[model samples]
Target: MNQFTHINASGEANMVDVSAKAETVREARAEAFVHMAAETLELIVSGQHHKGDVFATARIAGIQAAKKTWDLIPLCHPCYFEVEVQLEAIPAENKVRIESCCKLAGKTGVEMEALTAASVAALTIYDMCKAVQKDMVISQVRLLEKTGGKSGHFKVEA
Candidate 1:
Protein backbone atom coordinates (compact mmCIF):
# COMPACT_ATOMS: atom_id res chain seq x y z
CA MET A 1 0.00 0.00 0.00
CA ASN A 2 1.13 3.50 -0.70
CA GLN A 3 1.95 5.55 2.34
CA PHE A 4 0.38 8.93 2.84
CA THR A 5 2.60 11.45 1.10
CA HIS A 6 2.17 14.07 3.78
CA ILE A 7 2.89 11.76 6.69
CA ASN A 8 6.19 10.18 7.66
CA ALA A 9 6.65 6.68 9.09
CA SER A 10 7.08 8.41 12.45
CA GLY A 11 3.48 9.64 12.17
CA GLU A 12 4.50 13.25 11.82
CA ALA A 13 3.29 15.54 9.08
CA ASN A 14 5.98 16.64 6.66
CA MET A 15 5.96 18.91 3.68
CA VAL A 16 6.79 17.10 0.48
CA ASP A 17 9.89 18.35 -1.24
CA VAL A 18 9.28 19.30 -4.85
CA SER A 19 12.76 20.47 -5.65
CA ALA A 20 13.28 17.87 -8.35
CA LYS A 21 9.76 18.19 -9.70
CA ALA A 22 9.54 19.96 -12.99
CA GLU A 23 7.83 23.33 -13.00
CA THR A 24 4.80 23.56 -15.23
CA VAL A 25 1.73 25.64 -15.84
CA ARG A 26 -1.13 24.08 -13.93
CA GLU A 27 -4.82 24.83 -13.65
CA ALA A 28 -7.73 23.50 -11.64
CA ARG A 29 -11.42 24.11 -11.22
CA ALA A 30 -13.76 23.35 -8.35
CA GLU A 31 -17.49 23.64 -7.72
CA ALA A 32 -19.82 23.92 -4.78
CA PHE A 33 -23.56 23.93 -4.12
CA VAL A 34 -25.56 26.03 -1.69
CA HIS A 35 -29.13 25.12 -0.87
CA MET A 36 -31.59 27.50 0.76
CA ALA A 37 -35.28 28.29 1.02
CA ALA A 38 -36.95 28.98 -2.29
CA GLU A 39 -38.22 32.32 -0.98
CA THR A 40 -34.69 33.35 -0.16
CA LEU A 41 -33.57 32.25 -3.57
CA GLU A 42 -36.20 34.44 -5.13
CA LEU A 43 -35.02 37.34 -3.04
CA ILE A 44 -31.45 36.70 -4.15
CA VAL A 45 -32.51 36.60 -7.77
CA SER A 46 -34.34 39.88 -7.32
CA GLY A 47 -31.20 41.37 -5.73
CA GLN A 48 -32.77 41.27 -2.31
CA HIS A 49 -30.15 39.64 -0.13
CA HIS A 50 -29.71 41.44 3.19
CA LYS A 51 -26.15 42.18 2.15
CA GLY A 52 -25.89 44.12 -1.12
CA ASP A 53 -24.37 42.60 -4.27
CA VAL A 54 -24.12 38.99 -3.23
CA PHE A 55 -22.43 37.85 -6.42
CA ALA A 56 -19.78 40.56 -6.33
CA THR A 57 -18.93 39.93 -2.70
CA ALA A 58 -18.84 36.17 -3.12
CA ARG A 59 -16.61 36.44 -6.17
CA ILE A 60 -14.11 38.58 -4.32
CA ALA A 61 -14.13 36.23 -1.36
CA GLY A 62 -13.44 33.26 -3.62
CA ILE A 63 -10.49 35.00 -5.25
CA GLN A 64 -9.11 35.96 -1.89
CA ALA A 65 -9.57 32.45 -0.62
CA ALA A 66 -7.77 30.99 -3.58
CA LYS A 67 -4.81 33.27 -2.97
CA LYS A 68 -4.74 32.28 0.67
CA THR A 69 -5.29 28.55 0.27
CA TRP A 70 -1.86 27.75 1.68
CA ASP A 71 -2.48 29.69 4.84
CA LEU A 72 -5.72 27.81 5.42
CA ILE A 73 -4.43 24.33 4.55
CA PRO A 74 -1.16 23.64 6.30
CA LEU A 75 0.36 21.26 3.73
CA CYS A 76 -0.50 23.32 0.68
CA HIS A 77 2.20 25.44 -0.92
CA PRO A 78 1.55 29.13 -1.35
CA CYS A 79 1.17 29.65 -5.06
CA TYR A 80 0.90 32.74 -7.21
CA PHE A 81 -2.36 32.39 -9.09
CA GLU A 82 -4.86 33.68 -11.57
CA VAL A 83 -8.42 32.86 -10.72
CA GLU A 84 -12.02 33.37 -11.80
CA VAL A 85 -15.12 32.75 -9.74
CA GLN A 86 -18.59 32.34 -11.21
CA LEU A 87 -21.84 32.21 -9.27
CA GLU A 88 -25.19 31.18 -10.70
CA ALA A 89 -28.34 31.28 -8.65
CA ILE A 90 -31.11 28.80 -9.39
CA PRO A 91 -34.15 30.58 -8.11
CA ALA A 92 -36.50 27.84 -9.19
CA GLU A 93 -34.78 25.34 -6.90
CA ASN A 94 -33.54 27.65 -4.17
CA LYS A 95 -29.88 26.89 -4.84
CA VAL A 96 -26.70 28.46 -6.07
CA ARG A 97 -23.76 26.93 -7.93
CA ILE A 98 -20.32 28.33 -7.39
CA GLU A 99 -17.40 27.50 -9.68
CA SER A 100 -13.81 28.57 -9.18
CA CYS A 101 -10.89 28.14 -11.57
CA CYS A 102 -7.31 28.60 -10.44
CA LYS A 103 -4.10 28.63 -12.46
CA LEU A 104 -0.50 28.79 -11.48
CA ALA A 105 3.07 28.11 -12.63
CA GLY A 106 4.56 25.74 -10.13
CA LYS A 107 5.66 22.18 -9.39
CA THR A 108 2.28 21.29 -7.96
CA GLY A 109 -1.20 21.89 -9.32
CA VAL A 110 -3.68 24.37 -7.86
CA GLU A 111 -6.47 21.90 -7.24
CA MET A 112 -6.58 22.65 -3.51
CA GLU A 113 -6.73 26.35 -4.22
CA ALA A 114 -9.71 25.86 -6.51
CA LEU A 115 -11.46 23.65 -4.01
CA THR A 116 -10.81 26.11 -1.18
CA ALA A 117 -12.16 28.97 -3.24
CA ALA A 118 -15.33 27.08 -4.01
CA SER A 119 -15.83 26.09 -0.39
CA VAL A 120 -15.19 29.63 0.90
CA ALA A 121 -17.55 31.11 -1.66
CA ALA A 122 -20.26 28.67 -0.66
CA LEU A 123 -19.77 29.58 3.00
CA THR A 124 -19.85 33.24 2.15
CA ILE A 125 -23.20 32.65 0.47
CA TYR A 126 -24.52 30.92 3.56
CA ASP A 127 -23.14 33.70 5.78
CA MET A 128 -24.62 36.49 3.73
CA CYS A 129 -28.06 34.90 3.62
CA LYS A 130 -28.19 33.28 7.06
CA ALA A 131 -30.44 35.89 8.66
CA VAL A 132 -33.06 35.28 5.99
CA GLN A 133 -32.39 31.56 5.63
CA LYS A 134 -30.87 30.14 8.76
CA ASP A 135 -31.22 26.63 7.38
CA MET A 136 -29.00 27.32 4.39
CA VAL A 137 -26.64 24.43 3.72
CA ILE A 138 -23.35 24.33 1.90
CA SER A 139 -22.52 21.09 0.17
CA GLN A 140 -20.75 19.27 -2.65
CA VAL A 141 -17.59 21.29 -2.67
CA ARG A 142 -15.22 19.31 -4.93
CA LEU A 143 -12.62 19.44 -7.62
CA LEU A 144 -14.24 19.38 -11.05
CA GLU A 145 -11.16 19.30 -13.27
CA LYS A 146 -7.43 19.87 -13.30
CA THR A 147 -4.72 19.98 -15.95
CA GLY A 148 -0.94 20.22 -16.36
CA GLY A 149 1.69 19.32 -13.73
CA LYS A 150 3.19 15.82 -13.35
CA SER A 151 -0.11 14.05 -12.80
CA GLY A 152 -1.52 15.43 -16.04
CA HIS A 153 -5.26 16.05 -16.43
CA PHE A 154 -8.24 14.86 -14.44
CA LYS A 155 -11.98 15.37 -14.81
CA VAL A 156 -14.79 14.49 -12.44
CA GLU A 157 -17.39 13.57 -15.00
CA ALA A 158 -21.04 14.06 -14.26
Candidate 2:
Protein backbone atom coordinates (compact mmCIF):
# COMPACT_ATOMS: atom_id res chain seq x y z
CA MET A 1 0.00 0.00 0.00
CA ASN A 2 1.09 3.57 -0.57
CA GLN A 3 2.18 5.66 2.38
CA PHE A 4 -0.71 7.37 4.17
CA THR A 5 -0.59 10.84 2.68
CA HIS A 6 -3.41 12.11 4.89
CA ILE A 7 -1.60 11.27 8.09
CA ASN A 8 1.45 12.98 9.54
CA ALA A 9 4.61 11.24 10.76
CA SER A 10 3.35 11.90 14.28
CA GLY A 11 0.22 9.87 13.45
CA GLU A 12 -2.00 12.93 13.50
CA ALA A 13 -4.41 13.84 10.72
CA ASN A 14 -3.05 16.18 8.06
CA MET A 15 -3.76 17.21 4.52
CA VAL A 16 -1.33 16.30 1.78
CA ASP A 17 0.46 19.27 0.22
CA VAL A 18 -0.08 19.10 -3.52
CA SER A 19 1.38 22.44 -4.52
CA ALA A 20 4.39 20.70 -6.05
CA LYS A 21 2.45 17.87 -7.66
CA ALA A 22 1.86 17.87 -11.40
CA GLU A 23 -1.64 18.25 -12.73
CA THR A 24 -3.06 15.49 -14.92
CA VAL A 25 -6.43 14.08 -15.96
CA ARG A 26 -7.41 12.00 -12.98
CA GLU A 27 -10.57 9.92 -12.68
CA ALA A 28 -12.23 7.49 -10.31
CA ARG A 29 -15.35 5.37 -10.15
CA ALA A 30 -17.38 4.32 -7.10
CA GLU A 31 -20.30 2.03 -6.48
CA ALA A 32 -22.97 1.52 -3.84
CA PHE A 33 -25.78 -0.98 -3.37
CA VAL A 34 -29.14 -0.68 -1.66
CA HIS A 35 -31.35 -3.62 -0.84
CA MET A 36 -35.03 -3.46 -0.01
CA ALA A 37 -38.28 -5.36 -0.29
CA ALA A 38 -39.03 -6.78 -3.76
CA GLU A 39 -42.13 -4.62 -3.95
CA THR A 40 -40.11 -1.47 -3.38
CA LEU A 41 -37.82 -2.31 -6.26
CA GLU A 42 -40.78 -2.82 -8.53
CA LEU A 43 -42.23 0.53 -7.54
CA ILE A 44 -38.99 2.32 -8.39
CA VAL A 45 -38.70 0.52 -11.72
CA SER A 46 -42.28 1.50 -12.46
CA GLY A 47 -41.68 5.18 -11.62
CA GLN A 48 -44.02 5.08 -8.67
CA HIS A 49 -41.71 6.07 -5.82
CA HIS A 50 -43.88 9.03 -4.70
CA LYS A 51 -40.72 11.07 -4.37
CA GLY A 52 -41.46 11.72 -8.05
CA ASP A 53 -38.56 10.01 -9.87
CA VAL A 54 -36.18 8.45 -7.42
CA PHE A 55 -33.47 7.57 -9.91
CA ALA A 56 -33.42 10.99 -11.55
CA THR A 57 -33.33 12.88 -8.28
CA ALA A 58 -30.65 10.60 -6.90
CA ARG A 59 -28.50 11.07 -9.99
CA ILE A 60 -28.65 14.84 -9.65
CA ALA A 61 -27.99 14.64 -5.93
CA GLY A 62 -24.97 12.41 -6.51
CA ILE A 63 -23.44 14.87 -8.96
CA GLN A 64 -23.96 17.72 -6.53
CA ALA A 65 -22.39 15.64 -3.77
CA ALA A 66 -19.27 15.10 -5.87
CA LYS A 67 -18.96 18.82 -6.52
CA LYS A 68 -19.13 19.51 -2.82
CA THR A 69 -17.05 16.64 -1.47
CA TRP A 70 -14.30 18.87 -0.10
CA ASP A 71 -16.78 20.66 2.13
CA LEU A 72 -17.92 17.36 3.60
CA ILE A 73 -14.55 15.68 4.09
CA PRO A 74 -11.86 17.54 5.96
CA LEU A 75 -8.35 17.45 4.42
CA CYS A 76 -9.59 16.89 0.89
CA HIS A 77 -8.76 19.57 -1.63
CA PRO A 78 -11.61 21.49 -3.23
CA CYS A 79 -12.03 20.03 -6.71
CA TYR A 80 -13.51 21.07 -10.01
CA PHE A 81 -14.92 17.91 -11.52
CA GLU A 82 -16.93 16.24 -14.27
CA VAL A 83 -19.14 13.65 -12.65
CA GLU A 84 -21.71 11.23 -13.98
CA VAL A 85 -23.86 9.04 -11.74
CA GLN A 86 -26.38 6.37 -12.61
CA LEU A 87 -28.86 4.50 -10.41
CA GLU A 88 -30.04 1.22 -11.86
CA ALA A 89 -32.79 -0.92 -10.37
CA ILE A 90 -32.18 -4.66 -10.39
CA PRO A 91 -35.15 -6.50 -11.73
CA ALA A 92 -36.41 -9.62 -9.92
CA GLU A 93 -34.45 -8.47 -6.90
CA ASN A 94 -34.60 -5.90 -4.13
CA LYS A 95 -31.55 -3.88 -5.02
CA VAL A 96 -30.36 -0.72 -6.68
CA ARG A 97 -26.77 -0.10 -7.69
CA ILE A 98 -25.37 3.39 -7.84
CA GLU A 99 -22.29 4.08 -9.97
CA SER A 100 -20.42 7.34 -10.15
CA CYS A 101 -17.51 8.42 -12.32
CA CYS A 102 -15.57 11.58 -11.64
CA LYS A 103 -12.84 13.35 -13.58
CA LEU A 104 -10.57 16.25 -12.87
CA ALA A 105 -7.38 17.77 -14.22
CA GLY A 106 -5.69 18.74 -11.00
CA LYS A 107 -2.95 17.87 -8.58
CA THR A 108 -5.25 15.63 -6.52
CA GLY A 109 -7.23 12.62 -7.65
CA VAL A 110 -11.05 12.55 -7.37
CA GLU A 111 -11.47 9.25 -5.59
CA MET A 112 -13.17 10.90 -2.65
CA GLU A 113 -15.64 12.74 -4.82
CA ALA A 114 -16.53 9.57 -6.70
CA LEU A 115 -17.04 7.63 -3.53
CA THR A 116 -19.05 10.41 -1.92
CA ALA A 117 -21.32 10.64 -4.93
CA ALA A 118 -22.11 6.95 -4.95
CA SER A 119 -22.62 6.87 -1.20
CA VAL A 120 -25.02 9.79 -1.19
CA ALA A 121 -26.92 8.43 -4.15
CA ALA A 122 -27.53 5.19 -2.37
CA LEU A 123 -28.66 7.05 0.72
CA THR A 124 -31.04 9.12 -1.36
CA ILE A 125 -32.60 5.93 -2.63
CA TYR A 126 -33.17 4.76 0.89
CA ASP A 127 -34.59 8.10 1.99
CA MET A 128 -37.12 8.15 -0.79
CA CYS A 129 -38.32 4.65 -0.09
CA LYS A 130 -38.05 4.53 3.69
CA ALA A 131 -41.63 5.59 4.23
CA VAL A 132 -42.75 2.31 2.73
CA GLN A 133 -39.90 -0.01 3.53
CA LYS A 134 -38.29 1.13 6.74
CA ASP A 135 -35.74 -1.66 6.41
CA MET A 136 -34.16 -0.40 3.18
CA VAL A 137 -30.41 -0.37 3.53
CA ILE A 138 -27.51 1.33 1.76
CA SER A 139 -24.18 -0.44 1.66
CA GLN A 140 -20.87 -1.12 -0.10
CA VAL A 141 -19.81 2.35 -1.07
CA ARG A 142 -16.32 1.83 -2.56
CA LEU A 143 -13.88 3.11 -5.12
CA LEU A 144 -13.80 0.69 -7.99
CA GLU A 145 -10.81 2.20 -9.81
CA LYS A 146 -8.61 5.25 -10.14
CA THR A 147 -6.31 6.45 -12.95
CA GLY A 148 -3.77 9.17 -13.70
CA GLY A 149 -1.57 10.35 -10.83
CA LYS A 150 2.03 10.00 -9.66
CA SER A 151 1.03 6.93 -7.66
CA GLY A 152 -0.39 5.42 -10.91
CA HIS A 153 -3.57 3.52 -11.75
CA PHE A 154 -5.47 1.25 -9.35
CA LYS A 155 -8.20 -1.31 -9.79
CA VAL A 156 -9.47 -2.08 -6.31
CA GLU A 157 -8.75 -5.76 -5.54
CA ALA A 158 -11.98 -6.96 -7.23
Candidate 3:
Protein backbone atom coordinates (compact mmCIF):
# COMPACT_ATOMS: atom_id res chain seq x y z
CA MET A 1 0.00 0.00 0.00
CA ASN A 2 1.18 3.51 -0.66
CA GLN A 3 2.03 5.52 2.42
CA PHE A 4 0.28 8.81 3.07
CA THR A 5 2.64 11.74 2.75
CA HIS A 6 0.79 13.79 5.37
CA ILE A 7 0.81 11.05 7.98
CA ASN A 8 3.64 10.08 10.30
CA ALA A 9 4.72 6.52 11.02
CA SER A 10 2.70 6.65 14.21
CA GLY A 11 -0.39 7.70 12.21
CA GLU A 12 -0.40 11.27 13.39
CA ALA A 13 -1.27 13.94 10.87
CA ASN A 14 1.68 16.10 9.88
CA MET A 15 2.87 18.27 7.04
CA VAL A 16 5.07 16.61 4.43
CA ASP A 17 8.73 17.54 4.46
CA VAL A 18 9.91 18.75 1.06
CA SER A 19 13.26 20.16 2.06
CA ALA A 20 15.12 17.79 -0.26
CA LYS A 21 12.70 18.00 -3.15
CA ALA A 22 13.74 19.84 -6.27
CA GLU A 23 12.35 23.29 -6.94
CA THR A 24 10.81 23.16 -10.39
CA VAL A 25 8.13 25.00 -12.24
CA ARG A 26 4.78 23.45 -11.38
CA GLU A 27 1.40 24.29 -12.89
CA ALA A 28 -2.15 23.12 -12.35
CA ARG A 29 -5.49 23.86 -13.93
CA ALA A 30 -8.90 23.39 -12.37
CA GLU A 31 -12.50 24.11 -13.24
CA ALA A 32 -15.93 24.57 -11.71
CA PHE A 33 -19.45 25.24 -12.90
CA VAL A 34 -22.37 27.15 -11.50
CA HIS A 35 -25.80 26.25 -12.82
CA MET A 36 -28.65 28.69 -12.57
CA ALA A 37 -31.89 29.73 -14.17
CA ALA A 38 -31.79 31.35 -17.58
CA GLU A 39 -33.26 34.52 -16.20
CA THR A 40 -30.49 34.76 -13.64
CA LEU A 41 -27.85 34.31 -16.30
CA GLU A 42 -29.48 36.98 -18.39
CA LEU A 43 -29.35 39.41 -15.51
CA ILE A 44 -25.61 38.86 -15.28
CA VAL A 45 -24.91 38.93 -19.00
CA SER A 46 -26.98 42.03 -19.66
CA GLY A 47 -25.31 43.87 -16.79
CA GLN A 48 -28.70 44.50 -15.22
CA HIS A 49 -27.96 42.76 -11.95
CA HIS A 50 -27.94 45.18 -9.05
CA LYS A 51 -25.12 43.23 -7.42
CA GLY A 52 -22.66 44.59 -10.01
CA ASP A 53 -20.09 42.74 -12.15
CA VAL A 54 -20.22 39.12 -11.16
CA PHE A 55 -17.32 38.06 -13.32
CA ALA A 56 -14.97 40.69 -12.02
CA THR A 57 -15.88 39.96 -8.40
CA ALA A 58 -15.54 36.22 -8.88
CA ARG A 59 -12.20 36.53 -10.68
CA ILE A 60 -10.70 38.51 -7.82
CA ALA A 61 -12.09 36.06 -5.32
CA GLY A 62 -10.47 33.15 -7.14
CA ILE A 63 -7.07 34.80 -7.29
CA GLN A 64 -7.22 35.70 -3.61
CA ALA A 65 -8.32 32.21 -2.72
CA ALA A 66 -5.44 30.65 -4.64
CA LYS A 67 -2.91 32.81 -2.83
CA LYS A 68 -4.34 31.86 0.57
CA THR A 69 -4.75 28.16 -0.13
CA TRP A 70 -2.14 27.31 2.48
CA ASP A 71 -4.08 29.02 5.23
CA LEU A 72 -7.47 27.71 4.09
CA ILE A 73 -6.50 24.07 3.64
CA PRO A 74 -4.67 22.14 6.33
CA LEU A 75 -1.34 20.51 5.39
CA CYS A 76 -0.92 22.69 2.30
CA HIS A 77 2.46 24.35 1.90
CA PRO A 78 2.77 28.13 1.62
CA CYS A 79 4.32 29.14 -1.69
CA TYR A 80 4.18 32.27 -3.76
CA PHE A 81 2.43 31.68 -7.05
CA GLU A 82 0.54 33.25 -9.95
CA VAL A 83 -3.09 32.42 -10.61
CA GLU A 84 -5.37 33.29 -13.50
CA VAL A 85 -9.13 32.83 -13.19
CA GLN A 86 -11.60 33.09 -16.00
CA LEU A 87 -15.38 33.04 -15.84
CA GLU A 88 -17.57 32.39 -18.84
CA ALA A 89 -21.32 32.51 -19.07
CA ILE A 90 -23.17 30.16 -21.35
CA PRO A 91 -26.62 31.57 -21.91
CA ALA A 92 -27.75 28.56 -23.86
CA GLU A 93 -26.80 26.28 -21.01
CA ASN A 94 -27.84 28.74 -18.32
CA LYS A 95 -24.60 28.26 -16.43
CA VAL A 96 -21.29 29.84 -15.64
CA ARG A 97 -18.00 28.03 -16.06
CA ILE A 98 -15.00 28.97 -13.99
CA GLU A 99 -11.43 27.99 -14.79
CA SER A 100 -8.30 28.66 -12.78
CA CYS A 101 -4.63 28.10 -13.51
CA CYS A 102 -1.89 28.28 -10.92
CA LYS A 103 1.84 28.28 -11.55
CA LEU A 104 4.83 28.37 -9.24
CA ALA A 105 8.46 27.33 -9.05
CA GLY A 106 8.47 25.32 -5.85
CA LYS A 107 9.06 21.89 -4.36
CA THR A 108 5.36 21.16 -3.84
CA GLY A 109 2.61 21.13 -6.41
CA VAL A 110 -0.14 23.77 -6.70
CA GLU A 111 -3.07 21.52 -7.46
CA MET A 112 -4.82 22.51 -4.28
CA GLU A 113 -4.33 26.15 -5.10
CA ALA A 114 -5.89 25.77 -8.51
CA LEU A 115 -8.78 23.74 -7.18
CA THR A 116 -9.39 26.19 -4.37
CA ALA A 117 -9.49 29.10 -6.76
CA ALA A 118 -12.11 27.47 -8.95
CA SER A 119 -14.23 26.37 -6.03
CA VAL A 120 -14.18 29.76 -4.34
CA ALA A 121 -14.94 31.52 -7.57
CA ALA A 122 -17.97 29.34 -8.05
CA LEU A 123 -19.14 30.13 -4.55
CA THR A 124 -18.67 33.83 -5.17
CA ILE A 125 -20.83 33.58 -8.25
CA TYR A 126 -23.56 31.92 -6.27
CA ASP A 127 -23.32 34.52 -3.54
CA MET A 128 -23.63 37.38 -5.97
CA CYS A 129 -26.64 35.95 -7.77
CA LYS A 130 -28.51 34.36 -4.87
CA ALA A 131 -30.88 37.28 -4.54
CA VAL A 132 -32.31 36.56 -7.96
CA GLN A 133 -31.99 32.82 -7.91
CA LYS A 134 -31.73 30.70 -4.81
CA ASP A 135 -31.53 27.42 -6.74
CA MET A 136 -28.06 27.95 -8.15
CA VAL A 137 -25.76 24.98 -7.80
CA ILE A 138 -22.01 24.76 -7.64
CA SER A 139 -20.74 21.58 -9.22
CA GLN A 140 -17.94 19.76 -11.03
CA VAL A 141 -15.15 21.34 -9.09
CA ARG A 142 -12.06 19.36 -10.11
CA LEU A 143 -8.46 19.44 -11.30
CA LEU A 144 -8.19 19.35 -15.07
CA GLU A 145 -4.39 18.91 -15.27
CA LYS A 146 -1.18 19.18 -13.32
CA THR A 147 2.51 19.13 -14.32
CA GLY A 148 5.84 18.74 -12.47
CA GLY A 149 6.85 17.05 -9.14
CA LYS A 150 7.96 13.47 -8.52
CA SER A 151 4.66 12.02 -9.72
CA GLY A 152 5.00 13.78 -13.07
CA HIS A 153 2.24 15.16 -15.32
CA PHE A 154 -1.44 14.22 -15.23
CA LYS A 155 -4.30 15.27 -17.44
CA VAL A 156 -7.91 14.22 -17.33
CA GLU A 157 -9.10 12.38 -20.42
CA ALA A 158 -11.75 14.35 -22.23
Cα lDDT, model 1, residue 29: 91
Runs in model 1 deviating more than 4 A are: none
- Sort by lDDT, best first: what order? 3, 2, 1
Tens digit per residue, CA lDDT, model 1, 52-85: 8887888999999999989999998877889999
Model 2 bad stretches (over 4 Å): none
- In candidate 2, what are the lDDT values of residues 8-98, reduced to their tens digit? 9999999999999999999999999999999999888898777789999899899999999999999999979899998888876679999
What's the distance in Å from true for residue 14, model 1? 0.6
Give me the candidate number with maximum lDDT: 3
Clashing pairs in 3: none
Give the deviation of candidate 1 from the true structure as CA RMSD. Answer: 1.3
What is candidate 1's TM-score against the reference?
Answer: 0.94
Report the candidate with higher TM-score, 1 versus 2.
Answer: 2
Candidate 2 TM-score over all chains jointly: 0.95
Between the candidate structures 1 and 3, which one is better when assessed by lDDT? 3
Instruction: Give per-residue lDDT, candidate 2, residue 119.
Output: 92
lDDT of 3 by residue, 85-121 (tens): 9999998898999999999999999999999999999
What lDDT score goes with residue 15 in model 3? 95
Which candidate order results from sorting by TM-score in descending order? 3, 2, 1
